[model samples]
Target: MSGLLALLDDVAAIAKVAAASVDDVAGMAAKAGTKAAGVVIDDAAVTPKYVHGFEGKRELPIIWKITKGSLFNKLVVLLPAAMLMNAFAPWLITPLLMLGGAYLSFEGAEKIFHRLFPHADHEVEEDMDVGDPVHLEEARVRGAIKTDFILSAEIMTITLAAIPEGAFWMEAVTLALVAVAITAAVYGSVALIVKMDDIGLFMAATARTGFGRSLGTGLVKGMPKLMVFLSTVGTAAMLWVGGSIIIHGLDVLGWPVLYDTIHRWAEAVAHGVSEGLAGLAAWATSALSYGIFGLAFGMILIPLVTRVIGPVWSVLTGGSKPAAH
Candidate 1:
């Protein structure tokens, strides 16, 4: 009887440890996910555009296909790469993260530049000219997946950086959990945003109540504006997160000028404000400083990318040159 009781106690202890591990994984995943929020928002914002011009029936399937591709990118490709980096080349993480930050800065700046000085989008024109719907869909899907791979790399790297140093299994499990959760959140949001107008139309046409019909009508009208708002927010986030990453990275690498300057400015602003709002003031000041620097840095990169890198890449890949922005 005592032997059986001892075994039972051992089993309960094991179960308790397992439960604790699960909680740890969940907690780490949530924290890591928040760290990658800027990329996540941009992913959700960018995806719906890929489904444009497709039939409503096709939109969900396209999103599903992209979602599956995104999962594969994170799990099969990026997660392994991230693990390898952690194991063998841990020092590369910060530099790679800074590279991703630069990309985000360039992207956000390009969007703003295009908005300020409009240019014809040759890529969209090419898509419009494609005769075969099936081919166009395939091309768009491939393009989106390619784009997702880069963003997924960024997300995975950010998550990996956010994870506290721990056991190999714990880190692996945390990354996998973060991968699944982020993919679901991003693509699920994309699916809903893409289909919202259809839902609105259905409700408008079929709802029995007057309020329902009005709400449906409002949704239909509001979706475009909502998309624009999301895009603007995503761009701002990209710049903010990217700039912050670069500044912090510079500090880590022994170039603390930008980082220290930003902090000093934030501190000054914080002290100038009431105690209740000081923290908010500091954060706002820091963010604005980072964003302004990011915008300036990105602007410098624009001509170099378009004029030099774009042409070289096109030549090397045997692809058409990118259109000037």
Candidate 2:
């Protein structure tokens, strides 16, 4: 009887430890996911476009394919890479993160530039002109997966950076949980957004009540505006997060001038505000300052990227030249 009681007590203790570990994983994953919010928003916003113009029946299937590709990108490719980096080359994390941040900044700024300049998208036109639906779908899926790879790398890196150092297994589990949870959240939201029009149309046509019909009609009409809103918000988030990351990276790497200046400016603004709103004012000021810096940095990168890097990449990859921006 004593032996049995001891065994039971040992098992109970193990169970308690396991439960605590699970909670820790959940908490860490949530925080890491929050840190990667800009990339997550952009991923969700960008994915629906790959399904655009597809037959409604095919839309879900296409999204499923892309979602699978995204999972593979994050879980199979990025997760292992991140783990290896953490294990061996931990010092490289900040530099790599800054590179990713610069990429995000460039992407956001390029979007704004395109919007302002209103240039034609030759690549999009080429895709639209493709003869076979099957081939076009394949090409679009490949492009989207390629894009997702870059974004997923950013997400995983940001998540890894956010995780507090602990046991190796704890870090591994936290990263894995973050990868799965973030991929599911992004793709799940994409699925819903892509299908929303159909859902709204079905409701509008089939709903029994007048209010239901009106609501459905509203959804159908509102989706386009919603997409535009999401795009704008995603761009802003990218600039804010990217600039902040760069500044933070610089601070980590022993150059605190920019970071200190931004902090001082934010503090000055915060002190000028009423006590009740001081924190909000400071945060807003910091975010805006970061975003402005990101936009300028990104604009500088655009000419170099489009004029120099794009051509070099094309030559090396043996691909056609990128469209002129």
Candidate 3:
């Protein structure tokens, strides 16, 4: 009887430990997810444009396809690569992250350039030419997945860095959790944002009550403005996050002038504010500084990318125009 009791106690203790590990993984994952919020926001903001102009029936399916691709990107591709980096070339992480940050800055800046100059989008024009809906959907999904891969790389690296030192299994578990949760959150939000117009129309037509109909109408009208707002926010986020990464990377690489300068300026600004508002002021100042740097860097890369890289990429790809970021 005592032997059985001892065995049962051992089993119970093992279960307790397992439960505690689960909690730890969850907690760490949440913290890491927050650390990657900038990329997450950009991911969410950027995804909806892929579904734009698609029929209502196809929106969710396209989102589902992209979500699956994003999961594959994170789990099969980036997660393993990140683990390898952690194991063998942890030092490479910051430089690679800065490269990704530069890419983000370039993309965000390109959008602004297009807005200002109003160039024709060849990719969109090609999509319009594809008569088959299936083909068009496939193309868009592929493009979105490609975009997701880069953003996912940023997110995974950031998350990996955020996790506290632990067992290999624990780090793996934390990263996996971050991957699944962030993918679900990003694509889930995209799905809703894309389909919101349809939902609003349905509600406006089906609702019997006058107030319900008005609310539904409001939703339908509001969606366009909301999309614009999300796009603007996403661009700002990309610039801010990208710039912040470069600054942090510079500091890590022993070039701390820009980072320290920004810090000092932020501190000075904070000191001038009321205690309750000081933190907010400091953060805003830092973000603004980062954003300024990001924009400048992005502007410098734009001409080189379009004039040199784009043409080279086109030739290598057998004359296919490069996809717009």
Per-residue error for 111 in candidate 1, Å, reads 0.2
lDDT of 2 by residue, 79-127 (tens): 8899999999999999999999999899889999999998886776776
Candidate 3: segments with Cα more than 4 A from true spot: 128-130
Query: Looking at model 2, which ten-residue stretch has the lowest summed lDDT?
Result: 316-325
Once fitted onto the true fold, the runs of candidate 2 whose alpha carbons sit more than 4 angstroms away are 320-325
Summed over model 2, clashes come to 0
lDDT of residue 164 for candidate 1: 95
Error of 3 at 149 (Å): 1.3
- TM per candidate: 0.96, 0.96, 0.94
Model 2 CA lDDT for position 170: 89
lDDT of 3 by residue, 1-325 (tens): 9999999999999999999999999999999998788788878887887877778888899999999999999999999889988999999988988998898888888878888999887766776564678888888899889878888888999899889888999999899999999999999999888878878898899999998899889999999899788888888888998899999999999999999999999999999999999999999999999988998899999999889998899899998655555
What is the lDDT of every predicted structure here? 0.89, 0.89, 0.88
Clash count, candidate 1 = 0
**lDDT tens digits, residues 1-325, model 1?**
9999999999999999999999999999999999888889988988898888888899999999998999999999898889999999999999999998888888889999999999887766785564678998898888788889989999999999999999999999999999999999999999999989999999999999999999999999999999999999888888888898899999999999999999999999999999999999999999898888878878888899888998898998798654321
